[model samples]
Target chain A: SQTIHQWPATLVQPVGSPLSLECTVEGTSNPNLYWYRQAAGRGLQLLFYSVGIGQISSEVPQNLSASRPQDRQFILSSKKLLLSDSGFYLCASTGGHTEAFFGQGTRLTVV
Target chain B: GESVGLHLPTLSVQEGDNSIINCAYSNSASDYFIWYKQESGKGPQFIIDIRSNMDKRQGQRVTVLLNKTVKHLSLQIAATQPGDSAVYFCAADNQAGTALIFGKGTTLSVSS
Candidate 1:
């Protein structure tokens, strides 16, 4: 029974403000973590993924960055938020051979 | 460039009818495929998965079919209910087991 927890379920941040979204996994260790953004009616856009601590692979060049501070903790951050940065942020983890499990997701609105 | 795409952006089905959603991928190297369901304001939930070695896999009320030759995948929902109304996405694993490449998604609207 693995569970993923993501916080600030919803956030309204001003433009150019800093952003920090955290995701953590329980019941598993050394899992693969991923960060994705989904826009209205669009597909998920992979932002970052980490296979281990201190290792992050960014898929797109954008205003966001990711960090794996612990084996099961992943953080998505941004120094400044843009209007285009508003979307549903999802945190997912996989055991490498099974289906990935997703968190409740964070709905971020940059106004 | 490797990408996953859906054949349709939206679909409306009558309740109790069967629904079929289709997807296509560009990467033949992908060995795993998955289907996800996302309701409004919720994260995508895993529905079913199929490996490239198998052509089809079944879940409680859903079925996933993979056609490796054509690089296509499909999700079938039997006796669709209103609860089944959601955006469905198909994803493929890039073989490294590092990440999943997701498709644009198809919104299924089940009307009573």
Candidate 2:
């Protein structure tokens, strides 16, 4: 079975502070990884996605960036956080056309 | 750029009733679609998926219907419960191994 893990399930960051969220997948290799942000009462916005290590595609431009250091390890980072950055961030992995499994998610509160 | 969007922003239904949510996609090349449920303070969970080759697929109390002709999709939940109250999103994939384009979510509120 495949399992996805995310850390700092909940985060509170002051404005202009740095941000880092981690996501790791087990039981799969070379899977597609994605970062999505969903605001209250809004649809998810794809921030970035990686098909392989050291390769990433940005969907929406923002202060956030993504990196896939390993085959199954993905990280979302920001040099400075903004109040608008507050939202629910999700990490997803897909082995194929099969359903994409999501992590528990990181609730970022930028105050 | 092409995108996926929902027909409604919110839906309210009575417990034990069936619920249906609709989505529209602009990408004609999309060959795969998925439905997801996101509860409060949680990540989106996979509910069901349908391929472009098929028009419908069922899982437990949920059914996903795909209309490639209209580029529309729908999800039907049978005997809805309060626990089914969540934000539902539809995602589309045009190319294999590509990032899915997600639709704006519809908040389903089921009242007992």
Candidate 3:
């Protein structure tokens, strides 16, 4: 059983402001971590995924990036936010034996 | 999978009715599939999963059916309740099995 925790349930940032969202997992080791974004009425978009520490794969070219600093820690960061970056950001993890589990998500509103 | 620019499909049902949500995935090489339920302002919740080997898998009140032949997946919720009102979506592994690919969600609205 993997429990994912994401912080600051909601965020409102200026277009040029820097952004960082954190996701931490418990009860699993060497798990696959992921970052996804969903627009108000659209589907989930895969941002980045990491197989292990310091390994990240970007699905699409965007203003955001992801990193796995520790076995259970995954971070999504943006040097400068864009208005189009406003969406619901999600963190997910899948281990060798478990299905994908998602965190509560962070709603980002770029002003 | 590319994100749909359009809105998700909607399913409106009365309470106690059997609800079925449909999804069509791309990649035939995707051997694993999962279903998720998401409430407003919250993250997607794991509902059930079905592998390519088995065409069907059942949970407490939900069932996931896989059709690799046509590259389709479906979720069925028995006795749908108002609390079950949420966005239900499906995810599948890519050809490489490295990351999960998501499909546009279906908004399920159950009325009492």
Best by TM-score: 1
Predicted complex 2: DockQ? 0.76
| Model 2 per-residue lDDT tens digits across residues B1-112 | 7689999999999999999999999988888899999888888888999888899999999999999899999999999999999999999984544888889899999999
| 2 versus 3: better lDDT goes to | 2
Q: Which runs of model 3 end up more than 4 angstroms from their true locations?
A: B1-8
Model 3 alpha-carbon miss at residue A32, Å: 0.5
Q: Go through the candidates in order and give each one's DockQ.
A: 0.82, 0.76, 0.71
Give the residue spans of candidate 2 off by over 4 A: B94-97
* Candidate 1 residue lDDT tens string, B1-112: 5789999999999999999999999889898899999988888899999988899999999999999999999999999999999999999986576899899999999999
Please identify model 1 stretches exceeding 4 Å from their true place. none
Residue-wise lDDT of candidate 1 within A34-55, one digit each (tens)? 9999998899988899999999
Each model's TM-score for chain A is 0.98, 0.97, 0.96
In the range B31-60, model 3's lDDT, one tens digit per residue, is 788888889988998899888899999999
* lDDT, ranked from best to worst: 1, 2, 3
In model 1, which residue pairs have backbone atoms overlapping below 3 Å? Answer: none
What lDDT score goes with residue B101 in model 1?
A: 86
**Chain A in model 1: its TM-score?**
0.98
